[model samples]
Target: MADDSDLPQVVNRPGGATVGEQFRELLEARELIGFLAVRDLKSRYKQTVFGLAWAVLQPLIGAAVFLVLMTRVVGVDTDPVPYLLYVFVGFVAWTYFQASFTSASEVFTRNTDLITKVYFARLASPIAALVPGLVSVVVGLAVLVPMLLAYQRSPGWPIVTLPLWLLALFVATLGPALMASALLVRYRDLRQVVGLGLQTMLFVTPVVYDASGIEGGVRWLYYANPLAGVLAGLRWSTIAAAGPPTEAALSLGVAVVLVAVGMFVFRRFERTFADVI
Candidate 1:
Protein backbone atom coordinates (compact mmCIF):
# COMPACT_ATOMS: atom_id res chain seq x y z
CA MET A 1 0.00 0.00 0.00
CA ALA A 2 2.92 2.45 -0.42
CA ASP A 3 2.20 5.59 -2.36
CA ASP A 4 2.55 5.16 -6.18
CA SER A 5 5.40 7.63 -6.29
CA ASP A 6 7.37 5.70 -3.68
CA LEU A 7 6.46 2.19 -4.92
CA PRO A 8 8.88 0.08 -6.91
CA GLN A 9 7.73 -1.94 -9.95
CA VAL A 10 6.99 -5.63 -9.55
CA VAL A 11 9.44 -8.12 -11.09
CA ASN A 12 9.14 -11.70 -12.30
CA ARG A 13 10.76 -14.51 -10.34
CA PRO A 14 13.63 -16.30 -12.07
CA GLY A 15 12.69 -19.85 -13.04
CA GLY A 16 15.05 -22.29 -11.38
CA ALA A 17 17.24 -24.96 -12.98
CA THR A 18 17.51 -27.42 -10.16
CA VAL A 19 18.26 -30.68 -11.89
CA GLY A 20 21.97 -30.62 -11.10
CA GLU A 21 21.33 -29.27 -7.66
CA GLN A 22 18.67 -31.90 -7.08
CA PHE A 23 20.99 -34.69 -8.19
CA ARG A 24 23.57 -33.54 -5.66
CA GLU A 25 20.83 -33.36 -3.10
CA LEU A 26 19.89 -36.91 -3.99
CA LEU A 27 23.46 -38.08 -3.52
CA GLU A 28 23.39 -36.59 -0.08
CA ALA A 29 20.09 -38.30 0.55
CA ARG A 30 21.37 -41.74 -0.41
CA GLU A 31 21.20 -42.96 3.18
CA LEU A 32 17.56 -41.95 3.35
CA ILE A 33 16.87 -43.90 0.21
CA GLY A 34 18.51 -46.97 1.67
CA PHE A 35 16.50 -46.64 4.87
CA LEU A 36 13.29 -46.27 2.96
CA ALA A 37 14.14 -49.34 0.90
CA VAL A 38 14.92 -51.41 3.96
CA ARG A 39 11.75 -50.21 5.58
CA ASP A 40 9.80 -51.23 2.52
CA LEU A 41 11.39 -54.64 2.55
CA LYS A 42 10.50 -55.11 6.19
CA SER A 43 6.97 -53.88 5.74
CA ARG A 44 6.54 -56.19 2.79
CA TYR A 45 6.87 -59.23 5.02
CA LYS A 46 5.57 -57.85 8.27
CA GLN A 47 2.23 -59.59 8.16
CA THR A 48 3.26 -62.56 6.06
CA VAL A 49 3.96 -66.00 7.50
CA PHE A 50 6.75 -66.82 5.07
CA GLY A 51 8.44 -63.41 4.88
CA LEU A 52 11.12 -62.96 2.16
CA ALA A 53 10.46 -66.41 0.81
CA TRP A 54 7.49 -64.81 -0.90
CA ALA A 55 9.90 -62.99 -3.17
CA VAL A 56 11.49 -66.24 -4.27
CA LEU A 57 8.10 -67.83 -4.72
CA GLN A 58 6.73 -65.33 -7.24
CA PRO A 59 9.29 -65.83 -10.05
CA LEU A 60 9.57 -69.52 -9.38
CA ILE A 61 5.84 -69.93 -9.83
CA GLY A 62 5.88 -67.76 -12.93
CA ALA A 63 8.76 -69.71 -14.44
CA ALA A 64 7.14 -73.06 -13.72
CA VAL A 65 3.79 -71.98 -15.12
CA PHE A 66 5.31 -70.48 -18.25
CA LEU A 67 7.52 -73.52 -18.69
CA VAL A 68 4.51 -75.82 -18.62
CA LEU A 69 2.43 -73.62 -20.90
CA MET A 70 5.10 -73.02 -23.52
CA THR A 71 6.84 -76.37 -23.55
CA ARG A 72 4.44 -79.11 -22.46
CA VAL A 73 1.18 -77.63 -23.72
CA VAL A 74 2.28 -75.70 -26.79
CA GLY A 75 5.17 -78.01 -27.81
CA VAL A 76 7.41 -75.12 -28.88
CA ASP A 77 11.03 -75.90 -29.74
CA THR A 78 13.53 -74.08 -27.50
CA ASP A 79 16.51 -74.84 -29.80
CA PRO A 80 19.86 -75.97 -28.31
CA VAL A 81 18.73 -74.68 -24.95
CA PRO A 82 15.96 -76.17 -22.83
CA TYR A 83 12.89 -73.99 -23.21
CA LEU A 84 12.09 -73.88 -19.49
CA LEU A 85 15.56 -72.89 -18.38
CA TYR A 86 15.90 -70.21 -21.01
CA VAL A 87 12.51 -68.66 -20.36
CA PHE A 88 13.11 -68.75 -16.58
CA VAL A 89 16.26 -66.69 -16.93
CA GLY A 90 14.53 -64.12 -19.10
CA PHE A 91 11.50 -64.02 -16.80
CA VAL A 92 13.56 -63.21 -13.70
CA ALA A 93 15.29 -60.32 -15.43
CA TRP A 94 12.11 -59.00 -17.00
CA THR A 95 10.17 -59.30 -13.75
CA TYR A 96 12.80 -57.34 -11.88
CA PHE A 97 12.72 -54.54 -14.42
CA GLN A 98 8.93 -54.47 -14.54
CA ALA A 99 8.48 -54.48 -10.77
CA SER A 100 11.19 -51.90 -10.15
CA PHE A 101 10.02 -49.51 -12.86
CA THR A 102 6.34 -49.78 -12.04
CA SER A 103 6.93 -49.05 -8.36
CA ALA A 104 9.30 -46.23 -9.26
CA SER A 105 6.58 -44.61 -11.35
CA GLU A 106 4.31 -44.47 -8.34
CA VAL A 107 6.89 -43.15 -5.86
CA PHE A 108 5.75 -39.57 -5.50
CA THR A 109 2.11 -40.43 -4.92
CA ARG A 110 2.97 -43.39 -2.72
CA ASN A 111 4.82 -41.45 -0.04
CA THR A 112 3.26 -38.10 0.73
CA ASP A 113 5.18 -37.43 3.92
CA LEU A 114 8.57 -37.96 2.30
CA ILE A 115 7.76 -35.61 -0.54
CA THR A 116 6.10 -32.89 1.53
CA LYS A 117 8.58 -32.42 4.30
CA VAL A 118 12.34 -32.57 5.03
CA TYR A 119 14.12 -32.05 1.72
CA PHE A 120 15.54 -35.27 0.37
CA ALA A 121 16.24 -36.63 -3.08
CA ARG A 122 12.79 -36.88 -4.63
CA LEU A 123 14.19 -39.61 -6.89
CA ALA A 124 15.07 -41.75 -3.88
CA SER A 125 11.61 -43.22 -3.40
CA PRO A 126 11.45 -44.99 -6.74
CA ILE A 127 15.10 -45.97 -6.41
CA ALA A 128 14.29 -47.40 -2.99
CA ALA A 129 11.51 -49.66 -4.26
CA LEU A 130 14.10 -51.17 -6.54
CA VAL A 131 16.07 -52.57 -3.59
CA PRO A 132 13.91 -55.50 -2.45
CA GLY A 133 13.39 -56.46 -6.07
CA LEU A 134 17.15 -56.40 -6.57
CA VAL A 135 17.66 -58.55 -3.51
CA SER A 136 14.98 -60.90 -4.77
CA VAL A 137 16.63 -61.07 -8.18
CA VAL A 138 19.99 -61.90 -6.66
CA VAL A 139 18.53 -64.63 -4.51
CA GLY A 140 16.48 -65.80 -7.44
CA LEU A 141 19.67 -66.17 -9.45
CA ALA A 142 21.18 -68.23 -6.65
CA VAL A 143 18.17 -70.51 -6.64
CA LEU A 144 18.65 -70.98 -10.38
CA VAL A 145 22.02 -72.61 -9.66
CA PRO A 146 20.48 -75.82 -8.29
CA MET A 147 18.05 -75.81 -11.20
CA LEU A 148 20.95 -75.43 -13.60
CA LEU A 149 22.68 -78.35 -11.92
CA ALA A 150 19.52 -80.40 -12.18
CA TYR A 151 19.23 -79.58 -15.88
CA GLN A 152 22.96 -80.40 -16.47
CA ARG A 153 23.56 -76.86 -17.69
CA SER A 154 27.05 -75.49 -17.20
CA PRO A 155 27.99 -71.89 -16.53
CA GLY A 156 30.19 -70.61 -19.33
CA TRP A 157 32.75 -67.86 -20.01
CA PRO A 158 29.84 -65.69 -21.11
CA ILE A 159 28.59 -65.66 -17.53
CA VAL A 160 31.49 -63.35 -16.70
CA THR A 161 29.83 -60.72 -18.86
CA LEU A 162 26.74 -60.63 -16.65
CA PRO A 163 27.75 -57.39 -14.99
CA LEU A 164 27.77 -55.59 -18.32
CA TRP A 165 24.41 -57.13 -19.19
CA LEU A 166 23.02 -56.04 -15.83
CA LEU A 167 24.29 -52.50 -16.19
CA ALA A 168 22.41 -52.14 -19.42
CA LEU A 169 19.34 -53.63 -17.79
CA PHE A 170 19.47 -51.18 -14.93
CA VAL A 171 19.71 -48.14 -17.17
CA ALA A 172 17.02 -49.42 -19.48
CA THR A 173 14.62 -50.23 -16.68
CA LEU A 174 15.28 -47.06 -14.70
CA GLY A 175 14.22 -44.75 -17.51
CA PRO A 176 10.59 -45.83 -17.45
CA ALA A 177 10.55 -45.99 -13.67
CA LEU A 178 11.68 -42.39 -13.31
CA MET A 179 9.53 -41.15 -16.15
CA ALA A 180 6.42 -42.85 -14.78
CA SER A 181 7.08 -41.71 -11.20
CA ALA A 182 7.35 -38.09 -12.28
CA LEU A 183 4.28 -38.11 -14.49
CA LEU A 184 2.13 -39.80 -11.86
CA VAL A 185 2.48 -36.67 -9.77
CA ARG A 186 0.26 -34.93 -12.28
CA TYR A 187 -1.60 -37.84 -13.87
CA ARG A 188 -2.67 -40.59 -11.53
CA ASP A 189 -4.30 -42.48 -14.38
CA LEU A 190 -0.83 -43.46 -15.51
CA ARG A 191 -0.60 -45.80 -12.52
CA GLN A 192 -3.20 -48.22 -13.91
CA VAL A 193 -1.93 -47.67 -17.45
CA VAL A 194 1.54 -48.78 -16.41
CA GLY A 195 0.18 -52.04 -14.97
CA LEU A 196 -1.80 -52.80 -18.13
CA GLY A 197 1.09 -51.72 -20.37
CA LEU A 198 3.49 -54.06 -18.59
CA GLN A 199 1.07 -56.94 -19.13
CA THR A 200 0.78 -56.13 -22.84
CA MET A 201 4.54 -55.78 -23.08
CA LEU A 202 5.08 -59.20 -21.50
CA PHE A 203 3.00 -60.96 -24.16
CA VAL A 204 4.74 -58.99 -26.91
CA THR A 205 8.35 -59.39 -25.66
CA PRO A 206 8.98 -63.07 -26.49
CA VAL A 207 9.47 -64.13 -22.91
CA VAL A 208 7.78 -67.51 -23.30
CA TYR A 209 8.39 -68.11 -27.04
CA ASP A 210 11.65 -67.74 -28.93
CA ALA A 211 12.21 -64.60 -30.97
CA SER A 212 12.25 -66.92 -34.00
CA GLY A 213 8.55 -67.67 -33.50
CA ILE A 214 7.84 -64.15 -34.74
CA GLU A 215 8.05 -63.59 -38.55
CA GLY A 216 8.71 -60.87 -41.13
CA GLY A 217 8.18 -57.16 -40.32
CA VAL A 218 6.60 -58.26 -37.05
CA ARG A 219 9.95 -59.74 -35.98
CA TRP A 220 11.45 -56.29 -35.90
CA LEU A 221 8.72 -55.29 -33.52
CA TYR A 222 10.11 -57.66 -30.87
CA TYR A 223 13.58 -56.19 -31.38
CA ALA A 224 12.06 -52.75 -31.12
CA ASN A 225 10.81 -53.54 -27.62
CA PRO A 226 13.45 -51.97 -25.35
CA LEU A 227 13.48 -55.05 -23.16
CA ALA A 228 14.05 -57.45 -26.04
CA GLY A 229 17.76 -56.77 -25.92
CA VAL A 230 17.83 -56.97 -22.16
CA LEU A 231 16.04 -60.32 -22.10
CA ALA A 232 18.13 -61.52 -25.03
CA GLY A 233 21.38 -60.30 -23.53
CA LEU A 234 20.51 -61.88 -20.20
CA ARG A 235 19.77 -65.20 -21.91
CA TRP A 236 22.96 -64.96 -23.93
CA SER A 237 25.06 -64.26 -20.89
CA THR A 238 23.53 -66.83 -18.61
CA ILE A 239 22.31 -69.62 -20.87
CA ALA A 240 24.52 -69.31 -23.98
CA ALA A 241 21.66 -68.26 -26.25
CA ALA A 242 23.88 -66.10 -28.54
CA GLY A 243 21.18 -63.73 -29.74
CA PRO A 244 21.84 -61.05 -32.37
CA PRO A 245 24.23 -58.29 -31.31
CA THR A 246 22.68 -55.75 -33.66
CA GLU A 247 19.26 -56.23 -32.13
CA ALA A 248 20.73 -56.02 -28.64
CA ALA A 249 22.46 -52.80 -29.61
CA LEU A 250 19.14 -51.45 -30.83
CA SER A 251 17.55 -52.23 -27.48
CA LEU A 252 20.33 -50.46 -25.63
CA GLY A 253 19.96 -47.46 -27.94
CA VAL A 254 16.22 -47.32 -27.23
CA ALA A 255 16.92 -47.51 -23.50
CA VAL A 256 19.28 -44.56 -23.81
CA VAL A 257 16.56 -42.60 -25.58
CA LEU A 258 13.98 -43.48 -22.90
CA VAL A 259 16.33 -42.35 -20.13
CA ALA A 260 17.21 -39.11 -21.96
CA VAL A 261 13.57 -38.34 -22.64
CA GLY A 262 12.61 -39.24 -19.07
CA MET A 263 15.25 -36.99 -17.54
CA PHE A 264 14.37 -34.05 -19.78
CA VAL A 265 10.66 -34.43 -19.18
CA PHE A 266 11.02 -35.12 -15.46
CA ARG A 267 13.33 -32.14 -14.92
CA ARG A 268 11.10 -29.79 -16.82
CA PHE A 269 8.15 -30.55 -14.57
CA GLU A 270 10.00 -31.41 -11.35
CA ARG A 271 9.92 -27.86 -10.01
CA THR A 272 6.18 -27.86 -10.02
CA PHE A 273 6.14 -31.03 -7.88
CA ALA A 274 6.27 -29.27 -4.53
CA ASP A 275 3.35 -27.09 -5.50
CA VAL A 276 1.13 -29.57 -7.28
CA ILE A 277 2.06 -32.82 -5.64
Candidate 2:
Protein backbone atom coordinates (compact mmCIF):
# COMPACT_ATOMS: atom_id res chain seq x y z
CA MET A 1 0.00 0.00 0.00
CA ALA A 2 1.07 3.58 -0.60
CA ASP A 3 2.20 5.56 2.47
CA ASP A 4 -0.76 7.25 4.18
CA SER A 5 1.17 10.57 4.34
CA ASP A 6 1.42 10.65 0.55
CA LEU A 7 -2.37 10.87 0.08
CA PRO A 8 -3.76 14.26 -0.88
CA GLN A 9 -6.22 16.03 1.45
CA VAL A 10 -8.98 18.36 0.34
CA VAL A 11 -10.44 21.30 2.26
CA ASN A 12 -13.57 23.36 1.39
CA ARG A 13 -13.82 27.11 1.87
CA PRO A 14 -16.89 28.34 3.74
CA GLY A 15 -17.11 31.32 1.35
CA GLY A 16 -17.95 29.09 -1.60
CA ALA A 17 -21.06 27.73 0.14
CA THR A 18 -24.36 27.49 -1.80
CA VAL A 19 -27.91 27.64 -0.44
CA GLY A 20 -28.65 24.09 -1.55
CA GLU A 21 -25.55 22.77 0.22
CA GLN A 22 -26.32 24.81 3.32
CA PHE A 23 -29.91 23.55 3.37
CA ARG A 24 -28.71 19.96 2.98
CA GLU A 25 -26.28 20.48 5.83
CA LEU A 26 -29.09 21.86 7.96
CA LEU A 27 -31.26 18.83 7.17
CA GLU A 28 -28.44 16.46 8.08
CA ALA A 29 -27.98 18.28 11.39
CA ARG A 30 -31.64 18.18 12.42
CA GLU A 31 -31.00 16.20 15.59
CA LEU A 32 -28.43 18.71 16.79
CA ILE A 33 -30.91 21.49 15.98
CA GLY A 34 -33.54 19.79 18.11
CA PHE A 35 -31.08 19.44 20.96
CA LEU A 36 -30.19 23.11 20.80
CA ALA A 37 -33.86 24.04 20.80
CA VAL A 38 -34.56 21.94 23.86
CA ARG A 39 -31.48 23.35 25.57
CA ASP A 40 -32.69 26.89 24.90
CA LEU A 41 -36.18 26.11 26.20
CA LYS A 42 -34.81 24.58 29.39
CA SER A 43 -32.29 27.36 29.94
CA ARG A 44 -34.91 30.03 29.42
CA TYR A 45 -37.20 28.82 32.19
CA LYS A 46 -34.70 26.92 34.36
CA GLN A 47 -34.85 29.13 37.46
CA THR A 48 -38.07 30.96 36.74
CA VAL A 49 -40.84 30.45 39.24
CA PHE A 50 -43.68 30.30 36.71
CA GLY A 51 -41.72 28.19 34.17
CA LEU A 52 -43.71 27.58 30.96
CA ALA A 53 -46.73 29.31 32.43
CA TRP A 54 -44.93 32.54 31.61
CA ALA A 55 -45.77 31.96 27.97
CA VAL A 56 -49.51 31.86 28.67
CA LEU A 57 -49.24 34.70 31.13
CA GLN A 58 -47.50 37.09 28.72
CA PRO A 59 -50.27 36.97 26.09
CA LEU A 60 -52.94 37.09 28.77
CA ILE A 61 -51.43 40.22 30.25
CA GLY A 62 -51.08 41.84 26.84
CA ALA A 63 -54.66 41.00 25.94
CA ALA A 64 -55.86 42.42 29.22
CA VAL A 65 -53.97 45.64 28.65
CA PHE A 66 -55.26 46.00 25.12
CA LEU A 67 -58.81 45.10 26.19
CA VAL A 68 -58.79 47.93 28.67
CA LEU A 69 -57.07 50.51 26.51
CA MET A 70 -58.74 49.69 23.22
CA THR A 71 -62.24 48.83 24.35
CA ARG A 72 -62.82 50.78 27.53
CA VAL A 73 -60.50 53.72 27.01
CA VAL A 74 -59.96 54.21 23.27
CA GLY A 75 -63.29 52.62 22.22
CA VAL A 76 -61.96 50.89 19.12
CA ASP A 77 -64.72 49.01 17.29
CA THR A 78 -64.27 45.21 17.05
CA ASP A 79 -67.99 44.82 16.00
CA PRO A 80 -69.45 41.24 16.18
CA VAL A 81 -66.70 39.64 18.24
CA PRO A 82 -65.95 41.01 21.71
CA TYR A 83 -62.93 43.24 21.98
CA LEU A 84 -61.43 40.74 24.43
CA LEU A 85 -61.52 37.91 21.88
CA TYR A 86 -60.18 40.06 19.07
CA VAL A 87 -57.36 41.56 21.11
CA PHE A 88 -56.44 38.22 22.66
CA VAL A 89 -56.07 36.66 19.21
CA GLY A 90 -53.86 39.52 18.13
CA PHE A 91 -51.71 39.19 21.24
CA VAL A 92 -51.20 35.46 20.73
CA ALA A 93 -50.08 35.86 17.12
CA TRP A 94 -47.95 38.96 17.75
CA THR A 95 -46.26 37.42 20.78
CA TYR A 96 -45.02 34.44 18.78
CA PHE A 97 -43.63 36.58 15.97
CA GLN A 98 -42.02 38.99 18.43
CA ALA A 99 -40.41 36.36 20.61
CA SER A 100 -39.16 34.24 17.72
CA PHE A 101 -37.69 37.18 15.80
CA THR A 102 -35.98 38.58 18.88
CA SER A 103 -34.32 35.27 19.74
CA ALA A 104 -33.31 34.58 16.14
CA SER A 105 -31.70 38.00 15.79
CA GLU A 106 -29.36 37.21 18.66
CA VAL A 107 -28.75 33.53 17.90
CA PHE A 108 -25.36 34.12 16.32
CA THR A 109 -23.91 36.50 18.91
CA ARG A 110 -25.36 34.60 21.85
CA ASN A 111 -23.78 31.33 20.67
CA THR A 112 -20.44 32.68 19.48
CA ASP A 113 -18.45 30.06 21.37
CA LEU A 114 -20.44 27.18 19.84
CA ILE A 115 -20.16 28.57 16.30
CA THR A 116 -16.41 29.02 16.58
CA LYS A 117 -15.86 25.52 17.97
CA VAL A 118 -18.39 23.52 15.93
CA TYR A 119 -18.44 22.60 12.24
CA PHE A 120 -22.24 22.32 11.94
CA ALA A 121 -24.50 24.55 9.84
CA ARG A 122 -24.75 28.05 11.33
CA LEU A 123 -28.38 28.33 10.12
CA ALA A 124 -29.26 25.80 12.78
CA SER A 125 -28.86 28.41 15.48
CA PRO A 126 -31.54 30.76 14.12
CA ILE A 127 -33.87 27.91 13.17
CA ALA A 128 -33.52 26.48 16.69
CA ALA A 129 -34.31 29.82 18.25
CA LEU A 130 -37.81 29.57 16.75
CA VAL A 131 -38.69 26.52 18.88
CA PRO A 132 -39.41 28.24 22.19
CA GLY A 133 -41.67 30.78 20.56
CA LEU A 134 -43.53 28.04 18.70
CA VAL A 135 -44.00 26.22 22.02
CA SER A 136 -45.32 29.44 23.50
CA VAL A 137 -47.71 29.81 20.56
CA VAL A 138 -49.16 26.40 21.37
CA VAL A 139 -49.55 27.33 25.02
CA GLY A 140 -51.21 30.60 24.08
CA LEU A 141 -53.62 28.82 21.74
CA ALA A 142 -54.60 26.40 24.47
CA VAL A 143 -55.55 29.37 26.56
CA LEU A 144 -57.42 30.97 23.65
CA VAL A 145 -59.52 27.87 22.95
CA PRO A 146 -61.14 27.98 26.36
CA MET A 147 -61.76 31.68 26.12
CA LEU A 148 -63.42 31.18 22.74
CA LEU A 149 -65.65 28.53 24.24
CA ALA A 150 -66.47 30.80 27.16
CA TYR A 151 -67.46 33.51 24.72
CA GLN A 152 -69.69 30.98 22.89
CA ARG A 153 -67.70 31.55 19.72
CA SER A 154 -66.33 29.04 17.21
CA PRO A 155 -63.66 29.68 14.60
CA GLY A 156 -65.71 28.21 11.69
CA TRP A 157 -64.25 26.85 8.44
CA PRO A 158 -61.79 29.72 8.06
CA ILE A 159 -59.83 28.30 10.97
CA VAL A 160 -58.63 25.60 8.59
CA THR A 161 -56.39 28.24 7.00
CA LEU A 162 -54.68 29.03 10.28
CA PRO A 163 -51.63 26.99 9.38
CA LEU A 164 -51.12 28.95 6.17
CA TRP A 165 -51.22 32.24 8.07
CA LEU A 166 -48.74 30.86 10.59
CA LEU A 167 -46.40 29.78 7.79
CA ALA A 168 -46.58 33.30 6.36
CA LEU A 169 -45.83 34.76 9.76
CA PHE A 170 -42.82 32.48 10.09
CA VAL A 171 -41.52 33.49 6.69
CA ALA A 172 -42.02 37.18 7.45
CA THR A 173 -40.24 36.83 10.78
CA LEU A 174 -37.42 34.60 9.53
CA GLY A 175 -36.43 37.02 6.79
CA PRO A 176 -35.89 39.90 9.19
CA ALA A 177 -34.35 37.63 11.79
CA LEU A 178 -31.77 36.21 9.36
CA MET A 179 -30.97 39.61 7.90
CA ALA A 180 -30.56 41.13 11.36
CA SER A 181 -28.45 38.29 12.73
CA ALA A 182 -26.14 38.44 9.70
CA LEU A 183 -25.68 42.20 9.95
CA LEU A 184 -25.38 42.02 13.73
CA VAL A 185 -22.20 39.96 13.45
CA ARG A 186 -20.53 43.01 11.95
CA TYR A 187 -22.41 45.80 13.76
CA ARG A 188 -23.12 45.10 17.41
CA ASP A 189 -25.19 48.29 17.78
CA LEU A 190 -27.95 46.74 15.65
CA ARG A 191 -29.29 44.98 18.74
CA GLN A 192 -30.75 48.19 20.12
CA VAL A 193 -31.95 49.23 16.67
CA VAL A 194 -33.81 45.96 16.32
CA GLY A 195 -35.42 46.41 19.72
CA LEU A 196 -36.61 49.91 18.89
CA GLY A 197 -37.77 48.78 15.48
CA LEU A 198 -39.87 45.98 16.93
CA GLN A 199 -41.51 48.45 19.29
CA THR A 200 -42.37 50.68 16.31
CA MET A 201 -43.60 47.69 14.34
CA LEU A 202 -46.11 46.78 17.04
CA PHE A 203 -47.98 50.03 16.45
CA VAL A 204 -48.14 49.60 12.69
CA THR A 205 -49.09 45.90 12.73
CA PRO A 206 -52.79 46.32 13.71
CA VAL A 207 -52.35 44.42 16.97
CA VAL A 208 -54.75 46.60 18.98
CA TYR A 209 -56.61 48.40 16.17
CA ASP A 210 -58.58 47.12 13.21
CA ALA A 211 -57.14 47.55 9.73
CA SER A 212 -60.41 49.14 8.63
CA GLY A 213 -59.89 52.06 10.96
CA ILE A 214 -57.43 53.51 8.47
CA GLU A 215 -58.46 54.56 4.95
CA GLY A 216 -57.20 56.46 1.91
CA GLY A 217 -53.46 56.34 1.17
CA VAL A 218 -52.68 55.52 4.79
CA ARG A 219 -54.55 52.19 4.65
CA TRP A 220 -52.52 51.04 1.66
CA LEU A 221 -49.36 52.09 3.49
CA TYR A 222 -50.42 49.94 6.47
CA TYR A 223 -51.24 47.08 4.10
CA ALA A 224 -47.71 47.30 2.72
CA ASN A 225 -46.34 45.96 5.99
CA PRO A 226 -46.09 42.17 5.67
CA LEU A 227 -47.16 41.68 9.28
CA ALA A 228 -50.38 43.58 8.68
CA GLY A 229 -51.46 40.76 6.38
CA VAL A 230 -50.41 38.08 8.86
CA LEU A 231 -52.41 39.62 11.68
CA ALA A 232 -55.37 40.16 9.33
CA GLY A 233 -55.25 36.59 8.08
CA LEU A 234 -54.87 35.27 11.61
CA ARG A 235 -57.84 37.27 12.79
CA TRP A 236 -59.85 36.15 9.81
CA SER A 237 -58.99 32.51 10.41
CA THR A 238 -59.50 32.38 14.15
CA ILE A 239 -62.30 34.83 14.96
CA ALA A 240 -63.88 35.03 11.48
CA ALA A 241 -63.21 38.72 11.52
CA ALA A 242 -63.46 40.57 8.18
CA GLY A 243 -59.72 40.76 7.68
CA PRO A 244 -58.60 42.26 4.39
CA PRO A 245 -58.14 39.00 2.53
CA THR A 246 -56.81 40.60 -0.68
CA GLU A 247 -54.31 42.66 1.27
CA ALA A 248 -53.28 39.61 3.27
CA ALA A 249 -52.73 37.56 0.10
CA LEU A 250 -50.50 40.28 -1.26
CA SER A 251 -48.63 40.36 2.02
CA LEU A 252 -48.04 36.60 1.81
CA GLY A 253 -46.39 37.17 -1.55
CA VAL A 254 -44.27 39.89 0.06
CA ALA A 255 -43.30 37.48 2.83
CA VAL A 256 -42.16 34.90 0.29
CA VAL A 257 -40.00 37.49 -1.40
CA LEU A 258 -38.59 38.56 1.92
CA VAL A 259 -37.64 34.95 2.69
CA ALA A 260 -35.75 34.64 -0.61
CA VAL A 261 -33.92 37.94 -0.09
CA GLY A 262 -33.13 37.12 3.51
CA MET A 263 -31.64 33.76 2.61
CA PHE A 264 -29.56 35.39 -0.10
CA VAL A 265 -28.22 38.02 2.28
CA PHE A 266 -27.54 35.46 4.98
CA ARG A 267 -25.69 33.12 2.62
CA ARG A 268 -23.62 35.99 1.30
CA PHE A 269 -22.47 37.16 4.73
CA GLU A 270 -22.33 33.85 6.63
CA ARG A 271 -18.87 33.02 5.37
CA THR A 272 -17.35 35.85 7.42
CA PHE A 273 -19.25 35.06 10.61
CA ALA A 274 -16.68 32.71 12.13
CA ASP A 275 -13.82 35.08 11.32
CA VAL A 276 -15.43 38.37 12.41
CA ILE A 277 -17.55 37.04 15.22
**Candidate 1 deviant stretches above 4 angstroms:** 1-14, 213-218
Instruction: Report the C-alpha lDDT of model 2 over 62-97, residue by residue, as the tens digit.
Output: 999988887788898889878888888788888988
* Weakest ten-residue segment in model 1 by summed lDDT: 8-17
TM-scores of the candidates in the order shown: 0.88, 0.91
TM-score of 2: 0.91
C-alpha lDDT score of every prediction, in listed order: 0.78, 0.83
Give the clash count for each candidate. 1, 0
On TM-score, the candidate that comes out on top is 2
Model 2 pairs whose backbones collide: none
lDDT for 142 (candidate 1) = 80
Give model 1's TM-score versus the native structure.
0.88
